[model samples]
Target: MVAPARLDLDQRGDTWSSLPDHDVDVLVVGGGVTGAGVALDAVTRGLSVLLVEQRDYASGTSSRSSKLFHGGLRYLEQLNFSLVREALRERELMLTRICPHLVRPVSFLYPLKHRFWERPYVTAGLTLYDSMGGARSVPRHKQLSRTKALRMVPGLRKDALAGALLYYDAKSDDARHTMTVARTAASYGARLLTSAKVERLLREGERVVGAEVTDVESGETATVRCRVVINCTGVWTDDVQELAGGRGQFHVRASKGVHIVVPRDRINSETGLILRTEKSVLFVIPWGMHWIVGTTDTDWDLDKAHPAASRADIDYILEHVNTVLAHPLTHDDIEGVYAGLRPLLKGESESTSQLSREHAVARPQPGLISIAGGKYTTYRVMAADAVDAARPDLASNVPESVTEHIPLVGAEGYHALSNQVETIALRQDLPAWRVEHLLGRYGSLVEELFAMWAEDPSLKDPVPGAEEYLRVELLYAATHEGALHLDDLLARRTRISIETKDRGVTCARPVAELVADALQWDSGRVDDEVKAWEARVAAERESQTEAADQEANAERLAAPDFRNRSVGRALA
Candidate 1:
């Protein structure tokens, strides 16, 4: 028995063509981790759920994050004990039970500047961090002398540190993890659609009964009735609140963080590095073949979709990270650059980094609920809290959240399959590395995708110009992940655009063709998709080179808006 490939924008016309003319129990707007989590939680509790997004899943801030399921060591320093404990617990769940295949433990080295005073001060903190709930997942922190630390990382400058402390945190592929969770929601009978925009809230006597949705691809509109509407639009939460008629109980602020990626060989080290910046923390993390360094937090008043990285932002990270490096990296060394906005809870402080990371839920109206402002690590908790709050308006005695014990679709039986990758690769006539990649991303679901390749052996070859990716992955994205445009496959489904040095320039056309078939596009439509994707990349590159954050942000907003301009254009 096989489940039908997941529904997406390419199939929106056919899928929604026969959608019931009546309302659903809940309509969730946004497809990030939080939104997907909400859909999954709501469905398990017996609520009829429908989740829609303006673009592909995880295409916004979700995919652009630092890629760590962290407990936020900085939060511990701020005396935020509750946040750390809760986040640590979540981190353990992701690594040990929830999605072990996607989340894994990563070690980070923090070098001490002042000799005697700093080591003990930092050692005590690291000890407490290592002793947190389910801390057995990774090794405890270790203190090393200056010489030993230098020996461990020969790339470090001689005068950079007096000593070092090593500790652990968990990392994940944010985009893939999000897509899998959404698929899990679908398996549980929730209706999930991407590239479907919510044009307006359908209100009946001051209470929202449902939402009017527009299919961005075919230009068709449908009214999806629901007993309640959950606004999980992250940075756009306040804008969604206003759509419900300026009646929200709370507000949210946007803070932009920019990061740069370089090849791993440029910074030779055995472990990842964490450094203290004047304003915030800087992480030199290990991606598959690259090192991710960054994160400058500043108040953003520009575009939320494309938060630009100004020249100052780049220099701030470079300057701080360079202080400890034997060799400094220039613009030429950067392979890719990206910026994302954090939906932080608003505060009196001007510094974005100083703003609260805590989340809040409010039922500003009789049938509308809005959730905003929390770090990615706490997504599940935030989703549970949201459904609990919206339950009252659901007008039913809903059961307790069941998602905690639910393993996402690909999570169950993952550990044993990982051990069988080499054998599977041999039988499939593929490289072990490729098999590992598939298992890491899809877990036991790889068998389903591999069957497609077995039917047509040509699909076994790597994607043109994107050799690390197989054609089957692109096919899987459209068939199962709900990708619509070339951007959806390259930018979110596979991350080839950001992972490649040419930024997926050569691979765009082939991916566009694949999507064209799935969406039933003509020559003109295909050409428009290619043009739009190029323009999107051009705008992002231009924004990164700007001298100031606001200028860069404004320039980044020049591309086409994802929201339907005919009705809900200004996303605020």
Candidate 2:
């Protein structure tokens, strides 16, 4: 079998040099999960493909999701059965066949309020949810008494629950999952480019034949030719649609969802909690060492790129979540906070929460196809639909998407590697738990890390400020994971940005230096990268203190982007 393509700097240069020589069958704009999925789907169908993103992969909503692969239990209240069924099927695929290393089953507790009706209501919904996709991997819903519920979650006030019901869903690190999808696409011969922004659609008369892509890192431009261009720009869907010509068929409204991460000790619960709000539902998800409690759904009109979690947003989440807690949490308990925008298909409803999560694919013009408004769980389905929509422009017998049977990289030998974690740990001279951690994050790819460590014994040491990660991870991110900027390494590649209390500020310099070695950067470039990342974290913290969205946006925009700053300084 051909070795998987490495997305290092060397491969990036080779990809750019070869872009002009070949006519790609599909040109995918965006680097989120949906875009990555489209690239994989198109390429596996025997099509030459090129995918470009303006920023790091998953820097947008793809990274900042609620981090759940749930079937949307709340959707059942709206009676949206089809959407739920599709999502549940995808969730199962991720857990079992696709990327099991990334996605895993998680249980959530639904506290009962009324004595009689609530138990039956929640039980019925969960039963339907379990049987929807023929799910067998996760355990089915179990009914619990109030005494049992209180025993499980001692942090919850005794008065809060009449009883409870436990049900299973799934979760993953959103950014990691998206990046894995992109890497999987690259493994199948799809050309992946980051920091390559589409300046304009390259159109012949009225049909978009290709795109004039500009390198954000350097002031360079290239016109990439393709048979069809698929736009999967999420919240920026309307913007790209306008560039293609006009908004076709529908409009996408941005809905902001904010989540706060606190240390797990604060929430003394064995299982995650799902609470009902006046408008929607709230989830307290169990992250590794943290409890991610949040998500306020509201309309957002300000900047889609940098969706800030304002003081009001943070307070709103705390107030709602604190209602049932025996010990109330304050700002001091929050280690990390993040906000993401959902691209909802607009409807007559005034509330953003009421907007349909269903997606739409359209052939706006001859060579241009756009897909918008789908959940992260259903990205595979969306990709298949996008490719199906481009059928007229593609070959008469373009093979159907076969991604359903294809497992992502690192998934092939994962189970065997998992069983031998202790042996691997002993051989590598690391703790068993540390080896387990690496397995979950990298799966069978941990062998690559071990190989690197043999070459340089120092690579096994933990990072200076962040002891949870190894120094080799930084090197791996820069060398193999297409992490171009320091922000890419910290924010998306590792999630050190939002997982740490200091927002990765303390480890920024050391992490930058480690990446610089892999990327062959000079001292001045390292300094610039570190400075840019520090400024970004500071801006996010400052923005969170602001009371309004406008203020928060202005604060966030004040920080110079890492790429633009480096480019400007180099030119000067």
Candidate 3:
């Protein structure tokens, strides 16, 4: 097994310095899941690779997703059987072999409104769903009477359903999973850089060669020469294709998806809920101590960096989910709200929900490949397809992708370690639940956290407002997990922003102070970081009250991004 790569400021400097020295076989543009998957696939296939992201890893659509790894059950209703099968296969791989520590089974109850036809109609679809992916990692679907269903989910209104169907899917912390994939690729000799933007593509007589990248923090530029460039930027696909000096084969449309997080006690359900709406389906997903209920689909053309959820978007979710709940939720019950954009391949359908979820791979020109329009569940398949499309430009002996057989860093001995949780907690002088939490997030990588705790026992103490996460986890984020700013730690690494009612403002300064030494931040810099986060939270709160997208977007953009060099304050 390859030794894990430490992704910190020191390694980032080393990678940036070595950029002008050598040419790589493939240069990937984007740092989301697909880009990370492409890097892992390309490097493991014996190609020298470099992956660059304009912001932090999974800071975009990847981090702000439904956080489920399931076959789109609704796709089966659309008769898109092939896409469902492929996603289901990948879901099984993630559950058993690839990242067992990160992905786990989650059950959702599908309520039946009609008394007769709905039961068999849904039963056939679920049976097909259970059989399509070959070997299953989770149990099959089970039918429940209305009384039994109400007992299972006591919060459901008695009149909302005549019966229900319970089926299994999987969920994960998407940001952490994507970062781990990037780290796993780095462990296999791939170079990775965050806060680096690709200014332009290097061209030699219309044949693409490399890219000119700029450091977002230092304002320094470097020319990186490579054989081929894979454009995996999600919503910004068109923008990057313009850098290549041509229009892509297909256009990408950005669809806005918004979610609201509320405390778990507000919802009385052991299993998650799935509801059908006029345009699309809604998921009431169970997120640790909070319930993530949302996703309103609408066209968004305003700000791409931070999509804002307006009053209407939140009301739409509440109206739909409240139809089945015994107690309705209000704005005051919501702890947090977030918005993300989906990169859908533009089609004849006017509705964004009607757009295709299947991905496409196109060689728009020689030495360049553009991949767009896929669901999160099928990222590995999309990466494999994108790399396969580059084979003609690559060497003759370039091997096929071997990522299917390779386990991610934390998956090596995760199951064995999980069995010893009680013993580990006893030996470490910690509670059993804390050990379980660490094991679920880090898997066998918990050993690394143990080493830190051994050095400083105080690191085991919990954060001030976000007690669910230990101080050691925040230190690990700065020292090893490549967190450049306080937002990166509170927002993505630990999920303090959405999990807390104050949106991480109460703990922002304390967290900044805790990670100051590892990130080399001075006292003034610490104050600046905390202020930036507070401003962001304030903007989001103001934006959610607006009625229109234009108003909401302007409100959200009032906060200057600390990572943007134009803001004149570099958090990096």
Q: How many backbone clashes does every candidate have?
A: 2, 0, 0
Poorly placed runs, candidate 3 (over 4 Å) = 566-572
Is 1 or 3 the stronger prediction by TM-score? 3
2 against 3, candidate with superior lDDT? 3
TM-score of every candidate relative to the true structure: 0.95, 0.98, 0.99
Determine which window of 10 residues in candidate 2 has minimal summed lDDT: 563-572
Tens-digit per-residue lDDT, 391-504, candidate 3: 987898989889988888888899998899899999999899999889888888899999998999999999999999999999999988888988899888989999999999
- Please give, for residues 171-263, the per-residue lDDT of candidate 1 as tens digits: 988988888888888888888888788888878888988888887865788888888899999998988878777567777888888899998
Candidate 1 global CA lDDT score: 0.83
lDDT of 3 at 253: 92
lDDT tens per residue, model 2, 1-572? 23556789988888877878888999999999999999999989999999999998998999999999989999987899999999999999988989888889999989998998878888889989999976777899999999999899999998898999989999998998898889999998999999899888888888889988888877688989999999999988888878876547778899999999999999999999999999898999998889998899999999887898899999999999998899998999999999999999989999998998999999988898989898999999999999999999989999888989988888888889989988988999999999988888887888888999999999999988778889998899888889998889888888788778998989999988888767878988888888787788889999999998889888987778776935436423
Alpha carbon lDDT at 126, candidate 1: 83
Please report, in order, the local distance difference test score of every candidate based on alpha carbons.
0.83, 0.89, 0.92
Residue-level lDDT for 563 in candidate 2:
69
Better of 2 and 3 by TM-score: 3
